[model samples]
Target chain A: MSGRKLIALWLFVVSVVVALMGFWFMATRASMDYWVMAGSLILISITCYLSGVHHYLTTKNRHGRYIILYGSVVLMVAGLSIYIPDVLDLRPWEIYTRIPSDFFFSFFMLIIGILSSYVSFRPFHNFTKEGAQSGAYYIIHLSIIFTLFPLFLIMFNIITRGMGGITWEFLTEDIVSMGEKGGVYPAILGTLAMISLTAIIVLPLGVGTAIYLAEYARKGLAVRVIRTAVNILQGTPSIVHGLFGYAFFVLILFNGQKCLLAGALTLAILTLPIVTRSAEEALNAVPGELRDASLALGATKWQTIKKVVIPPSMPGILTGTVLGIGRAAGETAPIMFTAVYFSGTGTPSGLLRPIMALPYHLLSLYRLVGYRDVEPQAWATALLLLIIVLGINLSAIIVREKYRQRF
Target chain B: MINKVLELLKEEKACQRISLPPGIKAKTSGFSLWYGSTKALKDINIEIKENKVTAIIGPSGCGKSTLLRCFNRMNDTIVSVRTEGNIWLDGYDIYDDVTDCVDIRRKVGMVFQKPNPFPFSIANNIYYGCQVNDMDVEKDEVVERCLKQAALWEEVKDRLSENALSLSGGQQQRLCIARALAIEPEVILMDEPCSALDPIATAKIEDLIHELKKDYTVVIVTHNMQQAARVSDYTAYMYLGELIEFGKTKQIFEKPREENTEKYITGRFG
Candidate 1:
């Protein structure tokens, strides 16, 4: 091996030795908080080893070495604090004790650990190209891993606790009884109705505004101002929008009616920016030459935009719409002030009546934990919400891919 | 065979250098062009004729393409650019108060240097022009006839429903030609049509140009003097956005013309 390769081998050996020593120190230590101490030592040993290896290897070249070192250090520290127990702590199998930490730990651990694992498995060799590992790829892998594990756990939990009560009576019966026999049919309908209404209000306005901004808006002060406004809208927090919806749509416009329309409108505002940005990008991606060619053939500007530009961008626009739907369906904070109701006697009869959404349903179920029978219902609702979000996102991505192939 | 064509062109230029016949009855007078505030073409005067192939030959920065674009008013789409030109087509001023650009484009069609076909069926590409011009007649017949006029009907007839992009470069140019012809424009302006095609495709386009004069007036800009000689009925030599010479193609190619036009045609400083 070359001197550089030999140095790399030596550093790897040193790291393994340190890790082994740290593991031994923690494993043998009788202290109650040895898990925390051992975890930190193990983290430091791994960091030192990896950084030493990288520093030696890149003595002549430095581009991404520091980033990897810093990233590893961060992950190591986070891993130690979150998961590695603070001294052989023993606890009973309470769902609350295991649930929150498990959710957060695996979420962070699987994500950072996968990346660190990949780096550990495939150290940056001289042959690999730079900037090849992108954020989108990382997010996609992390999402799959995080989404699947929780989903599997939820499914297992639901089957063990939820299957017996998932009959037609449990599903179709009303929640008026405030007990085990009450069904979720009204809640389900209210949620569906609100989501559908939100889609109706958002699609035309979102797509129209996107088209106008992308195709018609000239590059000037006003256009720049409008673009900045849209960006601001996108960055604004959901809770603020909920407050605005409650003040305006619920209180003033509908005379204190906190109905489905008010909630739908709030969700529409929340989803608009996402759709507009994606649609704008898709529109911008259509080659200028296509538009020129169409116009040169005597088609009007509107005609060119309609026939040539929009058709090609349809897949991207649809993807944006799907993403917006996903956000709207999962949004709870905005709907809380403007739409959700826990004590409705029955399903909403019209647009003016208040409704229930799945996220709000999930949130409210948290309050029913003391009741034994209602616990199963909450888990089932949680599982259903996850299913809906995942289903929408997966199908949208698939459809977008199919259309991309066509183009 | 190449030498023979060159010699014929030289001999023809020598004999008819003294007297030149005016080729165009239509002319653009006091014409000036601007892109934003920068002038691309100054006030220029030139005339073009009916049922004749006129070649505008110039070097890279000479604005030959710009002049051709003005013929179809294709430059109108550039928002910051402005023009003050009186272009007359058969005694009707195309830049006058009554002129609609859509109508002007319908009457005076254009083909770009690059072969840009829509990502659609070959039939759709051809019919796009016809439909846009509101010539809503029998679609297939129009497509067939325009294809025939472009001398591309035979090769593409079997694949009318196929995507236009699937065709060869030469076929795509011909498809663009058929597209222009589908609108039945009185004049067709081609800017370096052969620049992007291979020798065989260039020759095919030359053949198509020869056949095109039977129906429509054709204006082509070319760097190849041989192409100008073989296809055009009239030739206008230009340099630095100024028209240096304009005459019959036979006369311009053969006789003792201005020294500049001669030096250019004789493969001197282009």
Candidate 2:
């Protein structure tokens, strides 16, 4: 038989072995502790099969099919041992959650897996071409499907939890009471203010430095130093940045006080290198031909930059800003140092008054979850925070897409 | 008496081409240029007659584009670039310390080789140069006159509001030409303007060049020998950053004075 036919046969045999193993795993007691391991094995087997590596590695004159069968049996035994060392030790409560009663998914997956593996690995007898008709495209499609599964799970979780607590009051009213009735209005407003101030500080300084490096300054010791500083800045940990922000902005600048300005300033410093590097890349990406065209058309260097280069780089600059926002919103350690706690009366009397943020609020709510008074409130707050962050991220993507359509 | 008659005929023929009365010259001077420590153009002297096409033909890296850029002081923007030259335009030394490079550029507009129309409407692209240079003009009249002068009014009349990028490559180049013309420059420098265009588009540009000589003194750098011969009145051929020959296009193509020029024109070496 041709190599293609042999490979196809190997794929079929391997899928059958995996399907059998999955069946064995599902058929075992529902009180098993090896659920994660079983899940992982199933994923690995599917990954190998779909990627077509399973066929390539095994079956020497159908000897490879035997290796898969042996490997799956060993894997299934090991997975069972790892998850559930002793069936006698299994708890009665664990039985309910551990074993899924509906075996339809496993069975359905087995059929689909057999069909797909056979279809993808099938040999073409009529074509004169040597070697397998490259399955790299299918392999990529499988990889994408694998990656999308986790993202889909996350989205589903977010929507199920998030939509429950999201409301006008949740978005706009301040968190007045301690538990459930309190809203994230102050936290939302605080985040907006923090981000806006960060932009105000970062944009000019970052863009100016980028311009100086890209356009004004020559490649020398100073430029190298600046570039190194920027790379280091980008590599610095968020928690380390939090420490620096506390030590520098909160303590040194404001005399050991946390204020809105302090938080914004810290975030700005954190965002500066990112913005500079991104803006420099954007500026560099502008074709030299465009600049030459503008200059030849009697535009001065400044005029050329303002008219041609900036407009083309706007989309990239916006992307950098979005990434910076992502970093700013998710950070809890920095806010813990610089700005935490929401005043109950209303929005901060001034910039100096401390403000609450969604991430910290979620953390507080999570800490209070065991308490009867705050458990529901905690869930509601977590849901609201997720919604806000998601909204910001999605809008940024939309804005970037709008500009990309022009190109 | 016979010698005087011959001289009179020669003067009359020069008048028909150059247009200026006796003793009045368009512009001529010593020009030396540098990019950092590297001298690009050295002690070059040439006269550009009013209302005539002067083609600068040379191999790559010979500073043809550099010399073209000097007319508008575009090199002034380069921090390391310097010039020890006298470039007089209408009896004014353009490189005088007080001369504004911006104003000089407005007067000496340029069209690049590849069509580099702004990502804007055709109308906006044409009006931008004028709006930048002459901001006080009555908008409609300026736009109409400039479009007519560029020979683009008829073709682009209906689609003036359309994006410049939506036009064909040749049309974009013409829009770029219209943009330069709108500034009402005394000279227009074209740096291998048709190099990026198709043959038909190139032919259209050559025809436009013939028509442009009536109102603008055009200096073009072209790699196409046939293009230089067909379009220009005078051609200066350079090699390795040195001027090898400067003469009528007919003489440069038909009977070059320099051996190197002969070799280059004969496709021996670039």
Candidate whose TM-score is highest: 2
Evaluate every candidate with DockQ and list the scores: 0.33, 0.30
Clashing pairs in 1: A32-A87, A33-A87, B12-B254, B12-B255, B13-B254, B13-B255, B14-B254, B14-B255
Q: Give the clash count for model 2.
A: 5
Per-residue lDDT tens digits for candidate 2, residues B1-270, read: 999999987765441122334322344456888888999987777777778889998888988988888888777767788888687776667777766777777788898878888876788777777655556777667667877777778988898788788988888888788888877888888989999899998998899999998888899999999999999998899776667789888998999999999998899988
DockQ score for model 1: 0.33
Least accurate stretch of 10 residues (summed lDDT) in model 2 chain A?
Answer: A123-132
Q: Which ten residues in a row have the lowest lDDT in candidate 2 chain B?
A: B15-24
- Output DockQ, candidate 2: 0.30
CA lDDT of each candidate? Answer: 0.74, 0.71
**Cα lDDT of model 2 by residue, A1-407, tens digit:** 75556655555565556555555556563333345445644653444343344344443233234334533653554344443223233257575433242243344334445433534343322112221344444556756976997889777776676666777777677676654566777776777777777788888888888888877778789999999998998888877878888898888988987888888777887888888988898888887766766776667678778877888788778777767766777677777788776435246546776677777777776776666466555666666666666776787788777875232
Error of 1 at A302 (Å): 2.1
In terms of docking quality, model 1 is: acceptable
Tens digit of per-residue lDDT, candidate 1, span A1-407: 55443543443344344344433444454223434433533553455455446655656555446545655674466546545443332346443333323233333433343444334322334324432354345447856976898768767876666566566765676765443447677777877788778778887887888888888877788889888988999999999999999999999998998888999899999998888888888988887767767777778888888888898788898888888888888888898999877745378778888886677876777776785457777766666666677788897899798988233
Q: Which stretches of candidate 2 lie over 4 Å from their true place?
A: A1-135, A162-177, A342-346, A371-376, A405-407, B1-43, B76-88, B91-99
TM-score of chain B of each: 0.87, 0.87
